[model samples]
Target: MHDITHRNRAESPSSKTLFKATAIALVVGAGLLVTTVLPAEYGIDPTGVGGYLGLTQLNAIAPQETAEPVEDPMISDAQLASLLNPVWKSSAPLRNDTLTITLGPNEGAEIKAQMQEGDRFMFKWEAQGPVNFDMHGERPNAGDEFTSYWTGRNKTNANGAFQAPFEGVHGWYWHNGGAQPVTVTVTTTGFYEKLYKL
Candidate 1:
């Protein structure tokens, strides 16, 4: 009688129901992967649901031919100090100045600081509109000889530290490339003699 009871339990309907439920779950999971997961994650929409939901844009691939990476070359405050020459010293008082320059469309202007070699300063400038700029230096009497430290295009703000590499003028040349006039406001603080327009 015990053997008969065990045989009957082994043949119960619960095992068949569990098998059917597992099979249904696997089919549903596979359907979701094809209709949703593949389209949203890989931008491959075979069922068209991802495109309708705008999920394809999340992982869309951009054209490689027109993509370019921009790099910022500004140096940090600590690096500016360490780059100064050991023999060069500044006894001048720390000065702060703010100047505004207006440029018409396609016009260019330069403002410089009279600095001796090894003088360090922090400078920040912003434009009312987009402008092109070159941060550079030149000797007092050097004929057409200049050194450019950094340059940027279509930028609205620039901030960085500068250590003079020579006894000369160090500053920026700004060019307004937009259709309207743009004003650039420059602020500087450091061991400089004076700030003047060039």
Candidate 2:
């Protein structure tokens, strides 16, 4: 209460006094920045005072980065190849093809690729809408005889790799049961003779 009476009557500091305090503060700050902060934080010692004060040793307590690989050690070419793609030997020539088909409501279509036995292939198919599909292969010289590998109902997409068991025409048969037309786009890359719509 007694100090509150002089709140409005307080004598403001003179410019000269303010300047002197600011100069002292600035000098102390610069000295600390050069001697303590730089050395302790970044191991950068401009003045030797920081090293003598053990502040520079504080920077060494932190971890140091290295160029060495942690998870990746020196590996053989076979190991590197397996890590990349792990290619399996196939007798069939490498062939890649993209096939697209549009099916109306209650309509079904078959897309097939001719491959020999033991021939491998990777296929991915995407449908604009839900569909029923059967991934199967037909045996050579067999009429209406087939082997079912995979089947799904109401699937939008599929990704798989197949090794022909006893190859003739291996492929997918997609049926659209929806009201609207669905466009199915399939991409295949592997050891197959050719891709065509049946």
Per-prediction TM-score to the true structure, in the order listed: 0.56, 0.56
TM-score of candidate 1 relative to the true fold: 0.56
TM-score between model 2 and native: 0.56
Expressed as tens digits, the lDDT of each residue in 1-198 for candidate 2 is 367655663477778889999999999999989999999999999889889999999998859777877676768898888789965677678999999999999999999999889888899999999999999999988998899999999999999898889869999999999999999999999998899999
Candidate 2's C-alpha runs over 4 A off are: 1-87
lDDT of 2 at 31: 93
Put down candidate 1 lDDT per residue, 43-118, tens digits, no spaces: 8888898888887887786746964554756877787878884455578679999999999999999999999888
Going through the candidates in the order shown, the clash numbers are 0, 0
1 Cα displacement, candidate 2 (Å) = 45
Backbone clash pairs for candidate 2 read: none
Local lDDT at 92 for model 2? 75
